[model samples]
Target: MRIISGKYAKRNLFTLKSNATRPTSDKVKESLFNSLGQFFSGGKVLDLYAGSGALGIEAVSRGYDQAFLVDVSGQACKIIKKNVDLTKEPERFKVIKTSDFRALKQFAEEGEIFDLVFLDPPYAKEKIIKVMNTLLENNLLAPHALVIAETDEHTDLPEVEGFELKKDHHLGRTKVKVYERT
Candidate 1:
């Protein structure tokens, strides 16, 4: 896969060799970012279930201040690091090899807040609502923060109290939803 835009536009990224991770396709990534205004001036990004770190890396490429990539798999973490290094600014990314929930808690403890959060967990084990609630409870989102959730067509995400659904669309078998904190 490759970064679709910004400073690192068209740069290739490495993915895991195993089937455990599903990397977001270029077309879907392009559409998702396009819907989010195509670029950012400055902000932090949290990439949970961060497979190959494409979402987070893309955010940094597009002028976001920093990106924190979290994944449960060791191999995925390695791939993420490789991708981040490819950006030539490893300092802008923090790669964590851990469960999404645990990372969320740790970020909360550290009083970290993000302007953008990307969720693309394995389709069969989607826990987006719970994760969103955790982020809310911990005040991990900055005001008007944007949350992008990518899931399979079967996974339906409801509108939660604190978040306003900005856009929801289907790209082939996958579904993409964007939410802004209310």
Candidate 2:
């Protein structure tokens, strides 16, 4: 996969060649960013299920100040680090190897807030609402922070009170739902 735009546009990235992870395709990533905003002024982004770190990396490429890429798998973290190295600006990215739950706890402990968060957890283990509630309860979301939740078309994500549905995009079986914090 490769970055589709911004400073790192066209930069090729490494992806895990395993079925355990479904990296977001360039087409969908581009569409998602376009639906929101292509470039950012300055803000931190969190990629909770950073399988290939593509989404977070793409955000940094598009101008987000820093990206925290968290993945449960060691192999994924290694790949993420390698991808970050490709940017030649390793300081702008933080790679963490941990489960989604632990990552959230760590973020809370560190008082880390995010301007954007990408949640694409494994389809079968989806608990988006719970995770979002944590982000909400812990004040992890900056004012009007945007969240992009990617899931298969079959999963019916319920509406959360504090977030407004920004965009509901469909591309074949893949569904991309963007929510903005209120």
Candidate 3:
């Protein structure tokens, strides 16, 4: 896969060979970013369930200051490191090899907050709500932080009290929802 826009636009990224991950398609990535404001000025990002670190890398490429890419798979973590290395600014990206919950807890304990977060867990084991709640409870989301959730079309995410659903669209077989903190 390749970055679609910004400083690292068109830069190539590597994907894991295992069937455990599904990299977000270029078309969907472009659409999702467009829906989230096309580009960012500068802010931190978290890519939970990061497959190839594409989403977080794209955010950094498009002007986000830093990104934390977390994945449970060893292969995925290696691929994410390789992809971040391509940017030539590895310092801007941090690859964490751990489960999503553990990563969230670590970030929370460290008083880390993000301006944006990408949640694209495997379709079968969707935990968007649980993750969202953890982020909220831990104060790991900056005021008005934006969250982009990618899921199978069959999944439906309910509206939570502290978040406002900004956009909800179906792109092919995928469902993309953008939520902003209230």
Candidate 4:
């Protein structure tokens, strides 16, 4: 896969060897950034279940101050590091090789808040609700922060406890939704 816009536009990224990871599509990524608009300027980003780290890398390339990438698999972590190096943005990125969503709480406790959060767990897993709750309970999101979730079109997302659904778009078999703090 490759970065679709910003300074890193057209830059290629490495992918994990395993078939378990599903990277966001170029169309979805472009649409996501377009929807973000001015929100991309100099803000912190958190990419949960980072996989190849494409989404977070895009944010960094577009001028976000920093991106924190968290993933459970060792291979995924390695691929994300490679992708970071590919972008030559090691200083602007942080990779967490952890297996639980709870670790995100530690970031929150450290007073880390993100302007944008990307969640694209494996399809059929229904991980969005659980992670969204953690973000809210930990106050890991900045005021008016945007959280984008890409999932199979059929995944059922509940009304998040403190988040309001801002936008939802279906792209073929995939669905992309944007949520804002209530």
**lDDT per prediction?**
0.91, 0.90, 0.91, 0.85
- Tens digit of lDDT per residue, candidate 1, span 1-182? 99999999999999998889888899999988888889899999999989999999998898899999999999899999999989999999999999988999999999999999998876533488888889999999999999898888888887777999999979999899899998
lDDT of each residue in 30-126, candidate 2, tens digit only = 8888887798898999999999899999999888999999999999998999999989999999999999889898999999999999999885324
Q: What TM-score would each prediction reach against the true structure?
A: 0.97, 0.97, 0.97, 0.93
Pairs in steric clash, model 2: none
How many residue pairs clash in model 3? 0
What's the TM for model 4? Answer: 0.93
Question: What is the lDDT, from 0 to 100, of the residue 97 in candidate 4?
Answer: 90
Instruction: Give me the overall lDDT of model 1.
Output: 0.91
By lDDT, the best candidate is 3
Model 3 alpha-carbon drift over 4 Å, by segment:
123-126
TM-score winner between candidates 2 and 4: 2
lDDT per residue, candidate 4, 58-111, as tens digits?
998988999999998988999999999987769999999985566686787798
How big is the positional error of residue 7 in model 4, measured in Å on the Cα after superposition? 1.3
Per-residue lDDT of 100 in model 2:
88
Candidate 1 at 28: error in angstroms?
0.2
Which pairs of residues clash in candidate 1, taking residues 3 or more apart in a chain or in different chains? none
List ranges where model 2 is wrong by over 4 Å.
Answer: 124-126
